[model samples]
Target: MKKIFLLPLISSLLLFNCTPKETLDETFQKINSEVLANSKAYATLGEATSTIGHRLTGSENGAKAEEYTYDLLKSYGLDVKYFPFEVETWMRGDVEVQIGNLNKRNYEVYSAVSLAHSPVSADVDLEIVDMGNGLEADYAAKPGAVEGKIALVYIGILPGSPEGTSNLHRSEKTALATDNGAKGIIIINQVDGGVLLTGTASVTGGLIDIPAVCIGKEDGLALKEILKKSKKRAKITMTNTSDQIKARNVIATIKGSELSDEKIIVGGHLDSWDLATGAIDNGIGSFAVLDMARTFKALNLKPKRTIEFIMFMGEEQGLLGSRAYVDAALKDGSIDNIKYVMNQDMSGNPRGFNAGGQKGADGFFDKVGEHIKAIDSVAFTNQNSNSAGLHSDHQSFMIQGVPYTSPNSNLDRSIYGCYHSDCDDFDLVNEEHIRNNVRFSSMMLYALADTDTLPARKLNDAETKAFLEGNGLKLKLKIGGDWRWED
Candidate 1:
């Protein structure tokens, strides 16, 4: 009898130990099923994109968008708050440029939205110097020689043989020119028919203290011809203003049950370019994350860790809101408790999504990919760039050594026709894409929040190399060699 009683007690202990694990899996399945049942959650993305519209940094529209996001999160019964930060405001005014001695007619040119905190300059006549491609060699050839002269630069296409890759180099050239005492800049777009493309000029550190504009390819060719014919200069006039302004980040938190101290953050920017209502660039991203938060609450599922939703302001103006949040969190030690951050910046495209993160985050990404693949809606590709370490809000947390990931579609020459342009609008978004992104994001958060064991934290070179090779990624590893630890 004693032996039988001991056997029964041992079996009961074993069952008790496995109960939480079984429950976790059951809860995940339930959440996934609910997501499938309510595919219209993506419609909220459309509504947010259409209703809030374009949200330029520091504009009234930006503020309105933030409030709307806050209210949306609050309506889901989450604790919502605002994190305010100070930023310099730059308002775009009328910009006009004319060619001299040729057609002599004022051609329509688009102003590159001036960086916030740049100095204002009125109409001025200045010499134009063709700095070929504005590379380091070009700048070294004539450093500081551009004082009081307008710099004419060819905004060369981004340097991959493939078309439409993001042009980080072009923005770098603009920054270098502004830093080297160029009074103003005129960039010639390399598009067909010399159509002028207008975009916001983002300066990271502070305001770019100079004026800049982009002209049509035809205008650029015309100017080159005029210079070739005779020693001619163009008279350009720009009116602008810059001042300190208030920026805020909208944050909402869904509290968890057992391990509420650990947190998972999900977000996208609440700002857009002033040109069109930034319906697709981020309005969709914002709505998808918000809808995820709502779904979590509606299901009445209790997570093991907290989930925080943020709608950042000033992303268009160089990720100011995210940067500020990270800086403040670091100063206040708020980041110490964060497990991971997932950002959804642009989810309107129907193509599959791209996943990237710190070198050691492969395990976390694999789990996310598995959850996404289970839904059969979105596929994940790994690119080992710092999801949180680069230009987006994720970068803010990356600076604090936190891990993060973003799910965005690839934009090689084949598919990146609408990023940051006037063309990024609501009609461009696919409902299936948005639904898949939201569903996957919810699953990822649920998995992280419910699991008791953390994913593997360190990655070896062999593992890293295999992961990158398998994913067809060509990333330049930037972390120091000593940072990798032997598993």
Candidate 2:
């Protein structure tokens, strides 16, 4: 009689203690509320910018930043590791540039920065040759004019350029000048009022034989005017250093209960150009990713597939960390397990998502957008796009036929003027903008991980080639020495 009474009591307790599982909508609502109330992204970014400064790869600051993010990930109660790889990285050194009539001794000294991967040392004084637009056709238009001279090229396509005229990257422009026997190259910044920009000018990620540097827009324009009146000469002097060093990519994993074989990667480049604090360029994206991981652990929500939050190093030098990761994965035959990649590079305030050339994935993303819209209709417009771009960590995975996506963002106009410039500091970042990236992206990632069937699959080699060609990226890839398919 006592045993029978205990059985009834046990059943009553079990029924009273069990709680219903949360629906997807309720989970999303919870994520929205939790992030708005106690978001850590802004504070973390403020601390990083104030304390760490520039996180240039292969430098002391770079290592500190790597460890900083690594420690934070560990603190979140997630499985984290360092993906170490060796690379020959470049760092800036002393540089000097002077422009005027060198023969007349009336030259004016101007401030300049050497482009990455420039030769270790260079001292050149040559007459300036104007190479408009810096395309192959421009060289053909004035045959042998730029030989043995310093080539002056515009960093952007000039206004009213002929229809269908394609602009080349600074590295490609450098290659064109070198192939034409130019002694040196000077790239004109497109921005006005003395704004300057710096980035790699080597296509192969190796130091070029010639010196390459950039000058402010106002200075370049003044030089161009002087050329119009009479001939002028440029003297470029630079000293850079390159060495073999080991850098690590930080990765934090959240394991799924079921369907753990399929994985989703959300990555951003942590390495920044050593100009300023890099608070705007990638600080917004990377720190937001960190907060997203924290949000996941705080809520302890387990989806169907695993998710990995990655902070890639050496991207500014040439996508070094990402390329290393992809190469190793391919060699070990683990590439097949990766289902998708979502990249954030200088991304902020995402109003929608980009499908990135994934066929049959539009409907899936659109449905996901509706859910995100429900969470914050004003911030997330649900305006989805489809395209593929290069010069980021995503390219490493996309080249291997992995489907990729990124946030479709419309940042403040003032922010873009600071890209790769010294003004890319903490002042430009807005808290609300980055918070949207964290909260909405987390929801989208959760959906992708938990879905029963993914709408897109890995593309074969031929399909990959076709996709690139259809998107008009074949020429750029070929110019950058990343084109794998034969003509």
User: In candidate 1, which residue pairs get closer than 3 Å at backbone N, Cα or C atoms, i.e. clash?
Assistant: 54-277, 54-278, 55-272, 163-413, 194-217, 388-394, 388-395
Candidate with top lDDT is 2
Lowest summed lDDT window (length 10), candidate 1:
476-485
| Runs of candidate 1 exceeding 4 Å displacement | 1-29, 39-42, 102-118, 139-148, 158-168, 178-181, 190-204, 221-232, 348-359, 377-389, 408-415, 456-487
Candidate 1, residues 61-173, lDDT tens digits: the string is 77877787778778778889999999776766666775454344444343343433344665655667776566665678887767667787777742332444334444566
- Give the Å shift of residue 285 in candidate 2: 1.0
Give the local distance difference test score of model 2.
0.89
Point to the candidate with the largest TM-score. Answer: 2
| Residue pairs in clash, model 2 | none
The sequence of per-residue lDDT tens digits that candidate 2 reaches over residues 1-487 is 9999999899988977686657778888888998898888889999999999998988999999999999999988988999999989889998999887858468778878899989999999999988878899999999999999999988998776788898888999999999999999999988877777889999988899899998898888778777888898988999999999889999999997698888899999898999898898789988988988999899998988889999999999999999999999999988888899989988888989998877677778889889899888999999998888899999999888899989998789889988898788999999999998988888888888888887578888998898888888898788777889889
lDDT of each: 0.64, 0.89
